[model samples]
Every structure is written in C-alpha cells, then in structure tokens.
Target: MTMAGTLYLIPNTLGPADAGAADPLRALIPDEVQAITAGLDCFIAENAKTTRAFLKLVALQHPLAKPLQEIQINELNVNTPEAMLPQLLQPLLEGRNAGLISEAGVPAVADPGANLVRLAHAQGIQVRPLVGPSSLLLAVMASGLNGQSFAFNGYLPVDAAQRGKQIKMLEERSRKEKQTQIFIETPYRNAALLETLANTCQPGTLICIATDLSLASESIVTRTAAVWKKQLAAGKAPDLHKRPTVFLFLGQ
Candidate 1:
C-alpha cells in the first residue's frame, strides 16, 4: 500500500463517555481507530500492551474487526520512538507515512511520542492529527473555572513538601487571576492531593473533581472546599482517583 505521506497523531477516546455517547466526536473514535488500522501503512504506539488492553475493553461494546497489530510494527510491540524510532523512521525514510498512537490521548501531550513528532518535523514530513477524546481536555471543559485562561500543569512533585508547595503556588495563581489550574496525580497519591488541596486552598475555593470519566463509574463534580471535605470524609471517595484523576481548581 502506498503511504499518504501524512503522519497521523491519533488520540484514543477510551472512556465510557466517548464509548457510550451519541455525540459526533464520541462516534468518531471507533471509526478513526478502524480507519487507522486499514488506512495507515505503518503505525507507532506508546505501549502495545496498554493499547491491547484498551482495545479489549472497547471490543465489549464494539468488536474491532481489525486488531492493532495489523498496522505494521504491531508485532514489534513498541509505542515510543525511543523504543521504535529507528524502525518506524526506517519506513518513513523510505518515503512511507507513519501513524503515532499514544496509550490514551494524543501523542506528546503527556506521553512519549514527542521524539517521533520532533523527528518527523525535522525530516520535513507532513503531520496530521485526528480528532479524539482527551481526559485532560474533558476535565477542564467541565471544570467550570475560567475557561478563557487556564494552564494544563502536568503532574506535580511527588515529595510531600514539594507537592504541598506546588499546590500552594497553583492555588495562588488561580486565586490571583481566577485562572483554572489543572493537573493529575498517580492513583495512590490521589487522596494525598485531595488532602493537600483541602488544606491549601481557601475555604470557599471552587474545586472540580472529574473521576473515572467515560467508564461505568464516570463522575465529575464541581464543589466547594468545605463540601468536598465533608463528602470525602463521609466516604464519597472517587473511583477516578483509583486509576487516574484530573484535579481542577479556581479559587474564589
């Protein structure tokens, strides 16, 4: 198959919301996933194992006629260019197009596909990105904060003191300008984040907790500092925190 000379950066909308929604964007994911398998001559993923697990879960609702490996390099079981750059770039160097797949969202936003993107640009290859779901973007959309101006601050420092200081700074920025602050934490440290926010943010600050989005347990709530404390303390813990959680705050 002749390549399109286009490198696709495809985002996987692997959430219950996208999987279950009737929205146009939601509907596009399954089609995109299928089309990439059939359309691309070669593809790259962040982690083949993670992608395989996601496909299986998606298959429960909609069986994939094509498995992921059908796209060349599937058998190689690699995702990052750091792992398969030379292999993927070989075909590209041969004038073939390649697709970049992150474990979840678009490559390089929060993943390791940056190297490939950089390399492709350096080599003068055309890069094309397809529309798909993103948990981080979704969290902010429903955060009810200053949508006009927000910063997607990635994971904060894991050390207790460092994390606390970072949270304090984020809180100050949001309060000073009413800008929304967004970030994520590892599963085990979610409650720790919640605890830090409860202690760091002001009493009346508005916090948005979007957990388990697009799954059977999908939940998103915009709450005040006081209310969130009571709910969490009363065992209304979020399952989203059990896996990956997006935390947004806009101090009032």
Candidate 2:
C-alpha cells in the first residue's frame, strides 16, 4: 500500500509584499518554513496569483523543487462545493505532498481553508502546521486584554445600526464571561468601525486596534472607549484606510 502524503499548513505574510521589513520574507518567515515551502510542488491556495508571488519570494531564499509553471496550484474559496473537496485532496491521496496556504496569515482560521483541513482529517491525511505570525494572536497578546480567555468573532455586521447592536452584544458577553472579544472589518470601513466602537461601547471598555501586523506600518493601541472617543473628537484617530487590521475589546 502506498503511504498517504502529509499536508503542510503554510502561512503567508499579513499584507503586501513590501509592507514589512526590508526582507519581509526573511524577517517574517523562519528559515525552516521557507525551506519547507520551497520544497512543495503541489498546493491548495486561496488565489493562484498570490501563491505564485509568495513562491517567488520563497525561491529567492531557497530554490523551488520544481519550476513555478510546473507547480500545481488549486483554488479554494467559500463558494467551493462540499462535493468537490475530495477532488482537491486527490494529490495527497496519490502520495504527493501538498501545502495549504492562506491569502493572509495562517490557513484555516477565518479562511475557507478550514473546510479542506477538516476533510483532510476525516480522510486520515497527516496535517502538519508550520509556525508563523497570526494577526489575531498578535493583537490579543499586545491588547493588554484578557488573553487568558478570548474569542475571535471574525467580521462584524457592516450596517451601522446592526453593527452597533452586535458590538454591544459582544461587549456584554465579554463583561459577563471576562473574555476578550476580537473581530475585524473591511479595510475601507475601518475608520467607521472605530468610530462606532468608540461611541457604542461603555466608557471604561478597552479597545485595541492592531493594524498591519508584522509590517513596518504596524500599529497596536489599547485604550478605553472614553479615551478613544476623545481622540476621535480631536480628529486624532489613526489612519486605517485600506489597511488590514484586527480589533479586540474587553469590557470591564
């Protein structure tokens, strides 16, 4: 019987290629992770274009096992049907090692890749997670909030009235459970979300805005709702336009 291939869970940079250090890949990705990524020829990625870009960077550090054109990259998105999961896993079932990569940060968490990971497990494929940066964990660690118990509440509602109500609900839940509530917003709507968070949450509630994690333009600030309100009034809110960010709050 042929041995099944192992599935490697790879992580990509949090933002644009040049968003971070002079050598972003060297700085953000460990040597081992780069080496492993460079050796994989089969991958499941959110976007083939971005995966090729990531591979080019990895190639700079460690030469790829096969040419870029020869590598097989399959796309996986939210709209992918449940019945097609097995087909995506065919490479592994055929004894070819494959990597699972996300558009940003780690795979599976807050990504459609989670479905593939679950399917891999059910099919008895060995899944190995590589070490890398995660915006959620980085935000929680720097928030000065209750990291002991926290939850990542993906993206909040976009509508102002509905979002405000959802924010209050999350705040209330945080207060009762002494848990930190974490979420994100569409980049363009970040400023609006910050405004709503400052205005809707209680005065003493703490909110941490971590933007561009692992990037040169990174910013992580934890302040009370009252203080944030004051900043907003003074037009001192950080510029979060078109930047990836993670928002966390803990109600007192």
Put down candidate 2 lDDT per residue, 1-252, tens digits, no spaces.
777899999999897776333455877889999999999999999888999989988887799999999999999988788888999999999999999999999999989999899999998999999998899999999989998999999999877788989999999999999999999988999999999999999999999999999988999999999999999999999999999999999999
Over the stretch 1-252, how does candidate 1's per-residue lDDT look in tens digits?
A: 444266778776544334334343335365655455445556676676665654544455454555655646442233323666655766776777667777666676877777777877887778887777688788888877788888888899988898889888888888898889998887788887887787767878888888876655767889888887877788886554466678999977
Off by over 4 Å in 2: 19-23
Off by over 4 Å in 1: 1-4, 15-33, 52-70, 74-87
Identify the leading candidate in terms of lDDT: 2
Which run of 10 residues does model 1 get worst, by summed lDDT?
A: 72-81
lDDT of each: 0.70, 0.92
Q: lDDT value for candidate 2?
A: 0.92
